[model samples]
Target: MELTNIGTVRDILGRHGFNFSKGLGQNFIINPDICPKIAENGNAKKGYGVLEIGTGIGVLTKELALRADRVAAVEIDTRLLPILDETLADFDNVKIYNEDVMKADLRGIIEKEFAGLRCAVCANLPYYITSPVIMLLLESRLPIDSITVMVQKEAAQRLCAAVGTRESGAITVGVNYYGTVKQLFGVSRGSFMPSPNVDSAVIRIDLNKKSELTEEQEKFFFRVVKAGFSQRRKTMANSIASLMGIGKSAVYSVLSELGLPEAARIEQLSMEQLMKFSVMLMEQTKE
Candidate 1:
């Protein structure tokens, strides 16, 4: 029942007929170093409740159980439940839910399972569903302390990229608004049972800072961000105008007031600059 051992993983999967689902991003880690490091990167200290998503055969889930007070893992693929049961049978602290993390009542789950304990999220996020999953976790504001995840190297770079860089996408801006991200370590493409084409990197996101704007303002601010990034090829004025449903002249005026060029690209603007400009634009449209 040693989940990180390649022979054990193969044995369990073969017994259950558990075929990997590319759509689910089902690449299970066989590297003994990777799973423990991922759990460590999660900051799963005593008394902390760690929630894991995509718990393939309960590998990382088992690691979290050793470090945290409670480990709740979500696995959308029910086919792996028997495997997880066999692998995780010894750990009394781990709970594997045959449920989708996105659709589950996270707040309620946290409240019920993690009462009096600090919460953190640790996952090997499914690549195709990464954006929505991260967005849901951030927006939930579920009294979580940190989020440490393993993502494709490119995605890792994009998520942790500095603001005002062209590497910053809408998700980058959105993630930056919510938490401070730091790169932890890289896992070679060869670390998995069925290796992914690209190497993966682990990143830790601490939910330390709160945005200066209120929730409603922040909502509209992200709307402005979407507008800014809507058409990368277009000038700021053009893109913002089209998405914000405002006039190009008005957008130009707003940029002028902000001391930015009307032709500025949204990706070139920092989160602070985006927030300042978006607040102004939102106010102007109201008037």
Candidate 2:
């Protein structure tokens, strides 16, 4: 059955006496085309393992299980287990766990279930937990090859935003350090049951093996980026001075050495420029 067949989903939930919980973000995708697109973009073929979050009504999970060798879907709402079991019965490869994705030990789960197979993450993420969930997957010790998620349109733009753009912020810079991000396509509000107030977009994050900096350097660079965006209206120097407890004169000196104007805002610096500024800050501290 395709995801667009909402009647089936409704029937299954009705049988189990399940009520959609607003807190869990229980919006079900009723667009069959989106299922295949998400699976294809995630590159989840046979022999690959997939970690799925927020598997509401098993619409997307059914599709993922068909494509991937093994699919582990973590759902915080235990009430939906029977419903998922009924909907996803034929797929022996699918495993449903009743736990919060944030609290689960992903490394242990992957090691025990997936073993040596390449892994990808797929989700129709809740708007509230989207940022933390994506960050958790990217920062995990597991071998996550890629991530394809459906998030609110605004959130998607922020994730794929380029440095020096209005949308760029700490999350944008942080994601860029780990991988390449792209907005795949947008989904209309009407495509989902109990439709969201806003539209959503699908995004892909391809992990990178070679980082330009050592672990320490990457950490320091992000620290600076976070501090830079801590006060959006303040100049970059003022923001860094306030966050890092450094003098405004010293911050300006570092910006001058990097050939950036003294009045430049934090939004004006790219990830590369941020790293260079971090190095200059270290040198100044040493002097």
Candidate 3:
């Protein structure tokens, strides 16, 4: 059977009486070439373990299995299990895990399934659950080499947004603190079985091997980041002051000490500036 063919996918679903869940944000990629592109851009390697989330009909999973030493494809939809079992029958390296990624013990599973191999995350992530999934993977600190995901185009832009730009959000800042992010490619809405309203794009984030940040400093950094981004239109100092329980004058004083304008918006600061601000704030809190 042509797994990436829409007719074949429909036939498989028909045989099993499987229905697409709107709540699940289900969209299966039906383009054969697209899967290989995602797998290649994700850096799936001969000796690496590729973690695949949202394995719709096992198209991308099959592609990853061809490259990676092992592929742990996690699917939340129980109905697709039989279809996956059939389609992935030929692939010995692919293992399907029937579990919710949000609730799974990912670290434990990675340790047992991946073992000594380097690991990367590759997924056609659901739009509704994209942020938490990506954030969980990043914060898991699981010795991940890279995270390559296909998300909504707008989301991809916000996630891989350039520092010091309005496109950057708190999530973008948080993501950069862990890895270097870049846009891999754009996948159109037409590529999927059930076409979505907006287009999608792929992003690749290579995790930083080392950061010049202490654990205590990291805590303060994110705290400040959270506070600054609490309100998008507000000035950085004002927003941070409101959320951090500090006086606006004190916030402005620190900004002036760093040679920043009192009117600077939260999105205007780069990752470097945020880190520097975190250090100064840490000193002030200590005093």
Candidate 4:
């Protein structure tokens, strides 16, 4: 079955009574070249199991199944279950779970489904939930090797942005804290059946096996980061003081100790600076 064929796709969807849901951000990829690349770069191979977040008529899901040892997809839209069944009927290695990826027991699923095989994640993510989903996958410390996803081009820039740069956001820091991200490729807006307004890009995040901070310190670091970026225009000292309920003087003192100007904005602080600043501020909080 040519999943990307407009006639085939329409017939399949029509037969299954499927209608695109804007609220769900349903944009099925019609580009034949994209899914194979996503599957390959995602590390879907003989010894690897692939966990897919969304099954858009089993398009990418089918590609992952062809390459990976096992393919498990968590799709929130139950309306696509019957469609997926028809689409993916030939693939015994693919399992479909009708559950929200955010709320699903991903760790449990990985353990049960992948067993001895190494695991990776591949998805054509909905633009609205991109950051939250990526953060969840990273923060949960899943045993997956890498996450390859297609997101809005603008979001791709933010996600893969350098932590201390203007394009960076809280998500950039959060993502970099857990993994190394790289933009893979770009896909035009016209690549989908119901094309999105914005172009999209594929990016990969290779999980870091080692964490620089302990559990307590890690939590504190994120807390400080959240506060730092809450008001991007404000100086880091001011933003941190305001959102974290710490005195501005104390924040200024920390900044001075770290050799950062009191006027330094959060975007201007490097990752090393942020780490040092977070630790020092955490110590002061305990005092």
Candidate 5:
């Protein structure tokens, strides 16, 4: 079946009585070139297992199945299950689960489904849940090598943006803490079956094999980072103090000890500086 062919896609979904759900952010890719690139760059290969978050008409899922040793996907919309069954029939390696990726047992899935194969993730993520999904995958600390997903172009910029830059936000800091992200390619808005208002881009995040911080430290670091970015216009010290209920003087003292100005903003601190600041603040709070 030509999954990317618009007519073929419509015929299949029509036969299955599938209607796109606006709330679900359903936008199936109609571009033939996009899925193959995602599969290839997403580390779907002979010895790899792939966990796909959303299988839109099985376009990307088929591509992943073709390359990987095994494919397990979670699709929230039950309406697409029959459509996926029809589209992915020939691939014995693909397993489709009707569950929310957010609440799904990802670690259990990785352990049971992947076994000896190196695991990776690939998805055509819904724009509304993009940040939450990415953060969930990262914070889960699953045994996945990388995550490759197509998201809104603006979101792609922030996700792949350099930390401490103007384009960076709290999520940027969080993403950088866990892995390195890079934009793979851009897909125009017209590439989808229904087409979306914004263009999209595929980005890859290679997870760090080992993290330097302990679990408690990691949690506190993100709390500080989130607080610092909560109010963009406020100084980092002021924002962190206000949100975290720490005295402003304490935050200022930590910044001063790190050779940073009291007026420093979240975007002004490099990842290294931010970590050092977090550690210092933790000590200050303990005192």
Candidate 6:
């Protein structure tokens, strides 16, 4: 049975007396094609451990359990526990935890249960918590090899945005620092039950082994990036000045020394340039 087929999903939910909750972002994918595609993009193969968030009705969870060696799904809603049990009963390797993923100790879980394996994270992220969830996975020490997630289309654009684009923001730069993000495919709003107002896109993030800077340098770079976008309409120099509580003239001097345009907006600077500017700011602060 196709996972995305409304009839099948509805039947499963109805049988279990399940009611979709908007607070949980319970717009389940009704398309079978998207489920396996998400697994494929996540590189979920036999012998790989997969971490899935929000296993509502086990639509995507079923696919992950089928393709991956072991699947650990963290679901927030306790009501879905029995539903997941019914759907995933045949797979012994699959474990469903009733907890908020944001608060769950994923690293400890992975270390204890799935030690010494390359893990991949796959999810149809809740629209409300998409950014935080993705950031949480990326920053975890659990050794995630890659991530494939279905997110709101606009958020996907921002995640994959180029430096010069309007969609570029602090999150874009942050995402770039950890990995390369690419939009794989798009799904119509109608493809979901209790359809969302906007469409969604599948985004694949490939973690990079070589980081451009040391940990300290990256932290400082993010501080500057966040300051730059703190006031989107202001020039980078002005924004940085406001954020740092420094004079605009000093900020302009830093920009001039770095050869960046005085009129440049926060969205105009590349990641490398932002790092350079951040380093300059730190040096000046020390002086």
Best by lDDT: 4
lDDT per residue for candidate 4 within 188-244, as digits (tens), equals 999998989999999999996588998999999998888878899999878887888
Decoy 1 TM-score against native: 0.97
Per-residue lDDT tens digits for candidate 2, residues 164-238, read 788988778868878899999999998899898999999999997567777777677767888888797789878
Give the Cα-based TM-score of candidate 6 against the true structure: 0.94
lDDT (0 to 1) per candidate: 0.86, 0.85, 0.87, 0.92, 0.91, 0.83
lDDT of 5: 0.91
Which runs in model 3 stand beyond 4 Å of their true positions?
Answer: none
For model 6, residues 53-162, the per-residue Cα lDDT tens digits are: 99978888888888888888899999889877777878898888888999998987776657767788899998999988887777663588888999999999999999
Greater TM-score among 2 and 4 belongs to 4
* Number of backbone-clashing residue pairs for each candidate, in the order shown: 0, 0, 0, 0, 0, 2
TM-score winner: 4
lDDT of candidate 3 over 176-229, digit per residue (tens):
888889998888899998999999999998997576689898887888888888
* Pairs that clash in candidate 6: 4-30, 4-31
**Least well predicted 10-residue stretch by lDDT in candidate 6:** 134-143
Between candidates 1 and 5, the TM-score winner:
5
Which residue runs does candidate 2 get wrong by more than 4 Å? Answer: 1-3
Model 5 segments more than 4 A misplaced: none
List the candidate 1 regions with Cα displacement exceeding 4 Å: none
* Descending-lDDT candidate ranking: 4, 5, 3, 1, 2, 6
TM-score of each: 0.97, 0.94, 0.96, 0.98, 0.98, 0.94
Score candidate 2 by lDDT: 0.85
Q: Cα miss at 79, model 2 (Å)?
A: 1.2
